[model samples]
Target chain A: MAKDDDTAFDQAGFDEALRRRARMVEAVLRQVLEQRPLAGEIARPQRLIAAMQHGVLAGGKRLRPFLVMESAALFSADGEAAARVAAALECVHCYSLIHDDLPAMDDDDLRRGQPTVHKAYDEATAILAGDALLTLAFDIVADEATQLAAERRAALVLALARAAGAGGMAGGQMLDLQAADAPPDEAGIIRLQAMKTGALIRFACEAGAIVAGAPAAERERLAEFGSAIGLAFQLADDLLDLTADAGTMGKATGKDAAAGKATLAALHGEDWARRQLAGLVAQARALLEPYGAHAAMLADAASFVAARNK
Target chain B: MAKDDDTAFDQAGFDEALRRRARMVEAVLRQVLEQRPLAGEIARPQRLIAAMQHGVLAGGKRLRPFLVMESAALFSADGEAAARVAAALECVHCYSLIHDDLPAMDDDDLRRGQPTVHKAYDEATAILAGDALLTLAFDIVADEATQLAAERRAALVLALARAAGAGGMAGGQMLDLQAADAPPDEAGIIRLQAMKTGALIRFACEAGAIVAGAPAAERERLAEFGSAIGLAFQLADDLLDLTADAGTMGKATGKDAAAGKATLAALHGEDWARRQLAGLVAQARALLEPYGAHAAMLADAASFVAARNK
Candidate 1:
């Protein structure tokens, strides 16, 4: 384990760490979205680049990236490489948000308390911006600056692609869109949530292991930990959507309910959902127990994910 | 050169070869887009998959894939590997087409004589399908089935990403969208066409070299050939758009002039565009001259691209 892994976990400490990592990710993303074009590129359209920056630079907890960083730290992975991977993951996350907020999808005007990409720019720009951001994620991972071995870099690309592709996040989005016409049953909702949100979060943790060249056993363990936290994250999100106001959430809340989308948290009632979150956080922490002190930050992350208000 | 390189490059032979390679690419693409989800995926949403198939499986010449296959053949690369790379390039190409046909973009209802994805399905499905296809392209390249060294796979991913991302195809699309409001000058039109269409074509030829583990000089040569052909391809396309009817082109034509979007061919008139095309084909063939008989098919391809009626 890295020396940094010995840091004690506390609510304030975890929050501070999350913010710091968000800043790190933001800095990397800002550079990635710079005005100058890369080699083999003709020119970067100002409107497209501006739209991409608007979608990605908006503030959030950067929870997914935090998971990548902390998970990598547990495996003693290179911090710089982990940061790039985190930023790449965040790009995928942000791109999905941009697309999901398009008029044909969720159709929201506000995101992170600002006009969504489609609202700020035209719909065509927003679509292209999202496409470009998604492509840029792979570019970042496969670039030499990530400083990983060729094999590790290839593995990262494969894993990230799977998590973000048809059978994963995008597929999940498709299911979510269908949910309005035919609300899913409990099992279907779980599957939808797992694919929609869990896959990327799982990849975030697994990416650390891939970057560190950790053993398969360790990779699987981190992945399982990720799965637990992923469920908890979604359940918590659904819970917030049910109870929180748009002002508190920064985006519109109660959207799932309005769309008649069935969520486990909504279906089983808030009480049951809270209990599930508790169990999931516990399950997530337990998976990390084998790592002892090195897992402290990850353990804190699970709790934070479940308990975050917005 | 392999034994296959000895074949004569008559028009019939070249057309047959192109069609053969297109079939190979289509087969690979079909398998890649199958209903069965890959590992780590929860489920493949049916509607999204169908929409993706509708977008991709619609028949075109598969010119980009053909370029990749032929370029790889120049270096004696594995045929199967080349085919996979070809399919991946086609995915990016198809994704761009799907998104570009959206109401917010080109607003076209027809593509290749069939209803566009958004017309056949809804706009949301079309968007998701495009997004998924783009993501799947990287997934296909990075997969072990490509049977390349990890370093080569990573390079392919990097190159493909750069070609398809903000500074390349997507960036070009943005510029093309903006062209209606502010038509580009001659130089600007060249840059826009290069990014929007040339980047992927360039990547296609360079990919064969990358897959074959060809040396830098060889790669550069193929890339330059690609550039020459790419410009020729766009010029030919612009000419056709100005002269051909929708019944012949199988999609809208003369839209560049209608939309007030400048193209070199449209700006300079038919005679100049034809002269430029002839020069570009000569330049392309000259780039491949060192390979002698081995590059005969590619030489033919340059002429074919510049002279194709549709």
Candidate 2:
């Protein structure tokens, strides 16, 4: 998506635009998982598929996949490529959330205003659900459902896998667990954010662009857009943790403070973090300008970055 | 594999082959997963990669991946297909082993005569390791490091995913946990065996041929080879629980009986299970002959099916 600064566009109108696009993502995901009926009883491993669908359907704001779709639209590519990549991206994102909410990790009992996977099912099923989602993401790719060429599809799969695997979200998770004792200094936070949040978002954009057959420079530009917006999204999340209500968010409010968890509010102080967040949103918006007209939706997404309460 | 009469091959010779082939599986698996030094502070996810490697490397008979390789060789394919599929199959099988050994499931403290994954590390790390391995299996296909065609790669991914997912292994697990009060019917036994053991072995053999560009009929033949052997493998396992020593088997014997777990031995008595097992092995061995000269190695594997303890 050409990342235009949507500060010039209708703010409410752009917000509405994103909501529409978000709906598209949900529709696409449901479409891809639609299968013919099965006969007899399903075996064990197959249970993971249903478990994955259960967790994913529990709902969250479809941001990562939205990013891919928005970015693909910015490139003037049809929604076909964006739709496929977005489904896979959502699978990875949903898997991460499920594992992160497990009893042994953050121990979250709720997400998006619903019971966590562990609470809804048991821990073992929750574990398998996460594992299945991770596996299913690649299954979707290796299924050749993507609109890209085979090599490009492979590239997309590799991108998502590497990001989600030991070096990416998994690495971030471990680091976050270790860092719970003391918030890392600036570099540590950056490294943590890079792995935990940046990798998948970056991959989402790049994979979508690859699907759209974007030129090398365009792919790089989309990546730049992804990194900036991705960080901004997390910064906003930190702010929301301190400011949003639990009921509104459908999650525990200020649980970070309750658990003595480290946050931007604790480390940088609220004012400084908010100021830095504003700067991040601005940088994110600026990154969209090069995509010209194509970046309208992305620019609006950036604008929303500073304002979303939950 | 076809159902066979009691007379198929020399039982004594076959036992030696299972022992020998199991060693080859171990060697092949170890050779692929050897650690290469990483550049930086290997992230937490990377640690999972290490943990997965460590857990998988801790060793078993390497039977599943070996089955894949040997079944592939039934088509006279080269080493490359066998080796790659071996790695892929091991990733899925070992991932299952890790999850199966978790605290929330069987709550076992030992595996392969060593600490189970949760005991080896923390429960969280073990969970992540299993998750990583499952993802890595798909990543292997998504990365498509081998010379497989796009369509073939997709098929392998779907097959493996389905094999390892709900209808395959996961479904079996659910049945296991949920079917504790289930009546000990013959169909119930067959259902459990198909999901728990039948799925991955079938995937392994079929994947090898799919990767080797084998024809559809031959792939079906390979699957039958896997199916008959898989059923036999489980039966043998049930039998060994009654007859084998801990030192030789490398696991705590009599635990199934102690746990009151249902097994062929529990239902049909040890003697009947044995006769049934011999018949299965003969049937397993016969499935490979259709490959003719290309079938020798697979026939050797079939012999190994029951020869291990004969």
Candidate 3:
């Protein structure tokens, strides 16, 4: 759907790259837990460490964090520094996933075809894992990637916090609950989509650019790309929730209808949902024209948004 | 139960003072939030701001943030700076409250005479509210406060994140779940409380002093005060869960009995629980001796911790 150019993006290579990147992220994040002055390390109590590792390591598309690394690579003098920036985004993303999978939230039993964190461990462990990941996101930025200006880095952390926070994903989620049963027109749906998905995606792209010291103008452009991609991502997701079967999608498929969700299927119908997704993908791709040579991976990543089946 | 020092502390005034302090904390928090960029501020379409405000101001003890401001005041700081620090702690405390109220964790319906965040709003809002509060806590700390040193303030922010995140309160919560219906022992109970309760309390005191530029060596002494009061506070909470009526408590009471939780009461019986509370109160009060004249309010606060019916 996002294929503006005829050249096929390396889907296989991108998948492979994401997997490798996720492993590296897990390695870096685990290093945080392992560092010791034992008593000084905030009393992790063995079990907590196990639970966190279990959730964070469970496989999924490590898209946002990968974008963090990739976007940083656009300007970072050091490749390793870019990787660390990437790792920070992973922390934020993983925390969000942990919360999203909780019994009280999305209530999914399966994530990435494995037991959701709450199912793999317990609800409390899942909550802690999410909290740890969220805090550790800032800790990593503060401790490892201080190459950015102190105030600026603080701003980046703040940016991530605001995006992933109550007003961002959390707020979006609340709107989502209301939109499911309440009357929300197209604008309301768009607003919910922007927050629930766009906030983090924008943060990921912006964080990358922020760390590498991209100009405000370029950063804003990248943020636009992120927001566009985020909307397309959700359009695809709502479509998937309706169309994908359990065997292919891993989780409970078509649960959206049962839940009475006002998804894309309900609003635009299947054909129009597909058409709207394609249009968003085109717009997302168009935003990348200025980044041109620099944003190849991000462009590829964005283009893949509506095209990917799962 | 801690009334052995009844002549030393005033219950009514302290309660009233605490209430006044809590309201002040909430107001200051609202002011700090206004500093955020309006573009990214919560959207009205989602009713995100309303949900965020509701979760936070739904009435809490605000003790931790109060400790932050009070500790800062002990060093003769500007009133505005102290208010910012106090409000930051309240943000953290409120986040924890929102998450704690979720069905996945403590599963309570009421908090402070109102419906829990999840109940009044929805599960998604409650999660976001918690996430938002946690994120905003760091945002406040990282933003420029009038008199704080960047390095020292950073240390305090890092400390709070550690305490609030995976390794501290979160880790404790995980352990709390793991310990449920398993076994009851003194060491286990202590570990649980220290993580769940002690972490935030310790940060509250230390963050205040950090902002005020208390010498690093002085932190150890203040930490002792925090540690003692933290335990006493938890003990008081556990006891309240056992003895307070639902009407007076504003939530379901005797929940420990219903859930068969492992508190000191569940572990050692009510007689042993009271005796242990007495011991902790003495230990808590003893740690404040060095504060001299100013310790009266702090000490009074500790005694009030013991005497509260709910």
- Highest TM-score: which candidate? 1
Native contacts retained by candidate 3: 0.48
Model 1 agreement with the true structure over B1-310: per-residue lDDT tens digits: 1112212237688889999999999999999989899876768998999999999998999989999999999899999999999999999999999999999999999998899999999999999999999999999999989899999999999999999999999999998988888888888888899999999999998999999999999999999999999999999899898888877887777787887878888889988888788888888988998999998888889888887877
For candidate 3 chain B, which ten residues in a row score worst on lDDT?
A: B37-46
- Give the worst 10-residue stretch by lDDT in candidate 2 chain A: A36-45
Estimate TM-scores for all models. Answer: 0.97, 0.88, 0.85
lDDT of 2 by residue, B169-189 (tens): 766776676556554477877
Candidate 2 achieves a global lDDT of 0.70
Per-candidate Cα lDDT values, in order, are: 0.90, 0.70, 0.72
How much is the lDDT of residue B111 in candidate 1? 90
Better of 1 and 2 by DockQ: 1
Quote the B-chain TM-score, candidate 2.
Answer: 0.85
Of models 1 and 3, which has the larger TM-score? Answer: 1
Each model: TM-score of chain B? 0.96, 0.85, 0.90
Q: Each prediction's Cα RMSD?
A: 4.2, 4.2, 3.9
